[model samples]
Target: SDYSQEPPRHPSLLINSKVPFNAEPPRSALASSYVTPVDLFYKRNHGPIPVVDDIERYCVDICSLIGTPKKLYMRDVRMLPKYNVTATLQCAGNRRTAMSKTRKVRGVGWDVSAIGNAVWGGAKLADVLELIGIPKLTCSTQSGGKHVEFVSIDKCKEENGGPYKASIRLSQATNPEADVLLAYEMNGKPLNRDHGYPLRVIVPGVIGARSVKWLDSINIIAEECQGFFMQKDYKMFPPSVDWDNINWSTRRPQMDFPVQSVICSLEDVQSIKPGKVTISGYAVSGGGRGIERVDVSIDGGKTWLEASRSQKTGVPYIADHVSSDKWAWVLFEVTVDIPYSTEIVAKAVDSAANVQPENVQDIWNLRGILNTSWHRVQVRVGQ
Candidate 1:
């Protein structure tokens, strides 16, 4: 593939791989704000970014296993209702770097910044499906359409140079409450090529893999997508399983990510004076679950303190509140006095009462995906 026409990236971003352009913003920058800036958003690409030069002529083909195909142009989609949905998209392998320490894992070596929250504007997929006689909440069509597949223009090695693709259940796609969108705008501005210029699928409360970018088509199928990403990659495997005796079909592709929390104010190892210190970071959960609370531990896992959580400034965060964006992340902070060197840790609890695991090894998988373990950082105090 030709890699000459790549888009410009933020200089502060830590580039993991250059060929397919996988980079993430600094950890501190990620937790500094509720909504991540577009430039600072993590970029996870499998192949060269495909450029869409002609916006007027761009269209997305929609078809099913046993129905006539339909095409929706950019103008056609824009004519529908526009919604500003604030959602957080987190990679399944968000904290793969920490997991690698326990055991070797495959895929990108990301820290804690492979996630971002943004307000996306676009027509609901339910509305778009309605245009073609598909009713809302339809699980299966008369012709046996059960899943909705998204095909992208970007080609990747995982697909053997074929277009990237993924899918979700038809019930999820047809449910307006799901907030599944065919997004065209990000943060009120038209999406840049790096983030899918013409169109993209925004599957809120799900792993970023299912939100395919640079969209080319949508297909209603009888079963889940059989693409490389859906079938082979992104699926979590048991820690005991290795490449020699791995069975791809044994596990389903990861959908919604687990409850996650990370400490971004300090690095893995840092030196500071013996005094009061402020710790802050991000907490989020999948499947529209809200963050109920965040627990901070100053002396390793001995004792814990409750941290304040908020989405908007000056507003108290309540789980599942009308004002709260259920799909977005909440920033947590707390202050404590440190008289000696100690280890700091942070863990989160979701609205469902699901708490993050205490140890990485407990949830450690061969793929290093879904490392929602307690975030720990070593602190060295000075006189």
Candidate 2:
């Protein structure tokens, strides 16, 4: 693969892999702000980045199983009303390294920084589909199309060097409330090449894998795309299944992630002053579910205290608030008196009352995806 065309990245990012360019910001960087800066956002790539020199000529083809296919230029998509959707995208492999410690797991090794929230500016996909005659909230087309597949220009070994692709149900794609976007801008500025430059699909509240970058085309099909990431990869499996006996088809591609929380203010193991220590981190849930609560335990889950949650500075975060950004994450913090060496843990509950599993051992899978177990860190107090 040609690495010459890859764009420059932030030096502060901790590089997990250099070839395909996967890295994430430091844990402290994540807790420092609400909307993560674009450069600080985690980078996960399966293949070498694709370069698009002619933005004017770059177009995304929209094809249906039975209707005439249409190619939409940037100008054509831009004509629709622009909506800024704030959403969090997390890799399914986030915290895979921790899972690996429990048992050897396959995939990129990531800490808790594998997630980030940003404001995406783009044309609503629902509105864009209407231009092609697909009505809002459409579940099926006259041609029996039930899924919307997004194909990318970036190719990877997973697909035998073919462009990366994934799909979402057509019903979700057409729901205006889903906030799906063909985003061209991130954080109020034009998207950098590291992200999908000219355009990319942002499937809010879903795992980032389905949100394909570097737009190429869209397909309306009767079934989900049989892409490698969609079928053989990104599925949840039982701990009993190993590579030899594993059956990929037995499981479904994971969409909305489970409730998760992480303590970013401290590392996995750190020494700190013995007085009052401030604990800070992020808590988020998938499928537009709001974070109902974040619990922090200083003595290793023996007892817990509720942490204050907020999305914007000075504003209290209320779960499922009518005015809250349902697709974004909430920041939680609590200052506790730590007089001795102890273990700290954080866990979250979603609006639906879904709580994170207590242990990673229970949720461990061969692929190490969706390790939404309670986050724990050991800390030593200085005399």
Would you estimate the TM-scores of all the predictions? 0.99, 0.99
TM-score of 1: 0.99
Global local distance difference test of model 2: 0.93
Candidate 1 global CA lDDT score: 0.93
Deviation of model 1 at 233, angstroms:
0.9
Residue range 8-122, candidate 2, lDDT tens digits? 8889999999999999999999989999999999999989989899999999999987768999999998899999999999999999999999999999999999999999999
Query: Residue 108: error of model 1 in Å?
Result: 0.5
TM-score of 2: 0.99
